[model samples]
Target chain A: EPEVTQTPSHQVTQMGQEVILRCVPISNHLYFYWYRQILGQKVEFLVSFYNNEISEKSEIFDDQFSVERPDGSNFTLKIRSTKLEDSAMYFCASSEGLAGTYEQYFGPGTRLTVT
Target chain B: ELKVEQNPLFLSMQEGKNYTIYCNYSTTSDRLYWYRQDPGKSLESLFVLLSNGAVKQEGRLMASLDTKARLSTLHITAAVHDLSATYFCAVVNAGNMLTFGGGTRLMVKP
Candidate 1:
């Protein structure tokens, strides 16, 4: 079965540096989302993208965070300046339709470590 | 704000035994999903309960949702060591955002 895939399975960056996490959603999927989980914490929604635009975002998705679907298959999340608390496992997900009606498939996740 | 909560955050059961994980959401939502995640692994979709009284089962696991009560249950029957993992339940809100519960970790010992 087709699955969402993410690049740079593990990323290490210095505090105050920038980093980009990339994802290639399942082919033919329409909606995309980004979620993060602090070690041993529940998954928290970051943002949702559709039609190449942000459809929804959480309070945690502040000005430092931005998402872009620069190409047909590549969706990326960029953090302008990383903080120690920003270290977490970031997961990219895709769904064929609205999340309320369809199941979202998650990627392997990129573990971001900021020191 | 929407909140999802799972009870008995950690469970330990012997092989061939049965147990259930409960998920309760604070708001109204018709769509509920159950996912499994192994240590240092990705989340695996297990069940999608879209409506009230919806139920789905696979292998040794079964899940049920009750929209009225805003509750969902994942039931494990005749558990095996391979079933060890963390299970999460998520509810979809109006903005198409999914709020997930603090997962339930299960360890099946022989």
Candidate 2:
């Protein structure tokens, strides 16, 4: 089965530094999303992207956060001026159809550690 | 706001036993999903319930949705050790944003 894949399975960055998490969603999938989970916490939605634009975003997705599909298969999330609270596992997912009945397939995730 | 709640956050059962996980969502939604996650692993899709009274089964797991009640249940007919994992029920609101339940941690002891 084709699957979503992410790069830099693990990352460590210092506070106030910028970090980029990359994902390659399944080819042929249209909608893409980013979610994060603080250690031991429920996964939280960050943002959804389609047609090179953001469809929806949560409060957590503030100005410091940005997403880009620079190429056909690459979806990336960049967090600027990271804080200690930014440490979490960032997941990238994609769905084939509309959001209403969409079934998103998620990547393994990228664990980010901020010190 | 959309919120998904799962009951009995923790479950322990003996092999070959049975149990169920309940999910209740605040607000209206007809699209629901069930996913399994092992320790430190990514989500594994289990089922997608799209309408009222929709039922889907795979292996020893069955999931049903009731849009009227905004509730869904994941029933384990015969729990096995390999089935132990954190199961989460997520609901997509009319806005189509997916919000996950608190999660139920199941442990099937052999």
Candidate 3:
């Protein structure tokens, strides 16, 4: 079975620097999503990408956060200026068809530690 | 706004026991999903319930959905240590985004 893959299993960056998280969604999947889980907190949605554009985003996805499908297979999330609160495990997910019916497959996740 | 809630946020059971986890949503959604996550790991898909009275079973775990009642249940029969993990149920609304419930953490003691 194919799976979503992410780069840099662990990332440690300075508080004011920029960081990019990369994901390679399943080859045939259409919709891609980013979600984060703070330690001991519920997983929170960040953004969803389809057709190289954002379909939906949560309030936490603010000016500092952006997502792009720069190429056919790679999806990336960039944070312009990292904050301490941004430290969390970021997961990338992809689904074949429309939501509410299809199952989304998730990557192993990238653990971002902003210090 | 859609809210998903799960009962018995934390569960501890002895090996070979059976228990049920309940999930309730606030709105009308035809699709519901159950996922499991071990500590520090990504979400793993368990079951997808599409309509009312849809039931899917895998090994010792069985999940059912009731769209009319806006509820879902995950029942474990003869639980074991390997089944210990955090389980989440998410409701898919019109937007295709999932609103997840506060997960239920289960621990099976031998």
Candidate 4:
């Protein structure tokens, strides 16, 4: 049972700082995604990656956010000039195929705290 | 736009009780998924409903999908404390991205 793995279980940063969350998706997965959950709120989608490029992104994924595979196993999400509202649990998910019928496996998540 | 709606946003039950949570979506997609999240934790995969009339069971929980009706249900039998968590159902459109429901918070007491 291969699982999605995220690093830096907890991250604390000051406002205006740049932060990167890392993930290692399942070995055979082709589609990758990023989502965030504000405390006590429903999880929100950020962006999805396939074919080494962004397939789709939510409005929340603005100029301030970017994602990259960078390497074969690592998927990274970078937030430029973090804000207080950016503090949330960031999750990484990967699936065997593209959207529609694919089932995604989610990572344990990285808790990002901005002060 | 695809919207996943779940009813009974909050549920509280005692041990040995049976309950069902309902999830509805507005679309024609056939792929649906259920996930569980405990407080201060990440989402855990529960069930994947691939098509109409698909039913899968695990332990004390069973999930069924009715694609024609654009609905899914997760039923728990003899619920226990361990089953207490926030359950969410997500609809996967053809794009492969998932639109998750608001979630149903369940509290099972002993």
Candidate 5:
């Protein structure tokens, strides 16, 4: 079956550096989302993207975070000026239809490590 | 705000036993999903319960949702060692945002 895929399975960056996590959603999927799971913590929603715009975002998604679907299949999340607390596993997901209509498929996730 | 809660975060059972994981959400939602995650792995979709009295079963796992009660359940039957994993239930609220519950980690000892 088709699945969401992410690049740079592991990312290591300095505290003040910028990092971009990339994802390639399923070709026919429309809605995309980003979520993060801190070590030993529950997975938290970050943002949702549809029609090249953000549909919803959580308080955790601050100014430092931005998402882009630069191309048809590529979705990316960028974080500027990362903090130590930013270390977590970032996951990308995509759905063929809206949340209530279809199930979302999740990628393996990119482990972000800030030092 | 939407809040999802799961009970008995950790469970250990012997192979061939049976158990259930409960998920409760704070608000009204018709769509609920169950996912499984192995250690250091990605989340895998297991079942989607879209309406009240919705039930879906696969292999040794079964899931059901109650929209009126805002509750969803994942029941394991004749569990095996391979069924051990962290299971999460997420409710899709307005704006198509999914609120996730604290996952239940199941360890089936053979």
Candidate 6:
């Protein structure tokens, strides 16, 4: 089965540095999303994207975060300035249709470690 | 805000045992999804329950959703060591964002 793929399975960056996490969602999926899981914590939604724009975002997705489908296959999440609290496993997910009606497939996740 | 909660955050069972993991959500939703994650691995989709009374089974695992009660359950029958993993239940909200419950970590020993 086709699955979402993410690059840089593990990333380490200095605090205050900019970092971008990349994902390639299933080719045919229509909706894309970003979620983060702090160690031993529940997954938290960051943002949702559709039609080349952000459809929804959580309060945690503040000024530092931005997402873009720079190409037909790549979805990228950039943090302008990283913080220790931003260290988490970031997962990219995609669904074929409305997320409420279709199951979203998750990527292997990129573990971001900021020091 | 939508809140999802899963009970018995950690479960240890002997091989061939049966157990159920319960997920409760604070808001109304028609879509609920169950996922399994191995340690240090990605989330794997297990079941999707789209409506009230929806039930789906795969292998030794079964999932059910009751939209009215805003609850979902994942039951493991005759679980084996391979079934050891963290299980998460996520509910889709009005804006199509998924709010995931804290996962249940299952350890099935031989």
Better of 1 and 4 by TM-score: 1
Query: Arrange candidates by DockQ, highest first: which order?
Result: 5, 1, 6, 4, 3, 2
Backbone clash total for model 4 is 2
TM-score of chain B of 4: 0.98
TM-score of each: 0.98, 0.97, 0.97, 0.96, 0.97, 0.97
Per-residue C-alpha lDDT of model 3 across residues A45-91, encoded as one tens digit per residue:
88888888899999999999999998899999999999999999999
Question: What digit string (tens of lDDT, one per residue) describes model 1 on residues B17-77?
Answer: 9999999999899799999999999999899899899999999999999998989999999
Residue pairs with clashing backbones, model 6:
none
Candidate 2 vs 3: which has more lDDT: 3
Predicted candidate 6 versus true structure: per-residue lDDT over A44-97, tens digit per residue: 999999999999999999999999999999999999999999999999999898
TM-scores of chain A across the candidates, in order, are 0.97, 0.97, 0.97, 0.97, 0.97, 0.97
Docking class of 3: medium
Ten residues in sequence with the least summed lDDT for candidate 1 chain B? B89-98
- In candidate 3, how many Å is residue B35 off? 0.5
Segments of candidate 3 deviating more than 4 angstroms: none
TM-score, B chain alone, candidates in order: 0.98, 0.96, 0.99, 0.98, 0.98, 0.98
In model 5, what is the error at residue B45, expressed in angstroms?
0.4
* Candidate 1: Cα lDDT at B103: 98
Native contact fraction per model: 0.84, 0.50, 0.53, 0.66, 0.82, 0.87
- Looking only at chain A, give the TM-score of model 6 against the true structure: 0.97
How many clashes does the backbone of model 2 have?
Answer: 0
Which 10 successive residues of model 4 chain A have the least lDDT summed? A96-105
> Residue by residue across B1-110, what tens digits does model 5's lDDT show?
88999988999999999999999999998789999999989998899898899999999999999888889999999999999999999998887788899999999999
- CA lDDT scores, all candidates in order: 0.95, 0.91, 0.93, 0.93, 0.93, 0.94
User: Looking at candidate 6, what is the lDDT of residue A108?
Assistant: 96
Error of 1 at A50 (Å): 0.8
For model 5, residues A1-115, the per-residue Cα lDDT tens digits are 7889998999999999999999999999899999999987789999999999999999999999999989887999999899999999999999888845688889999999999
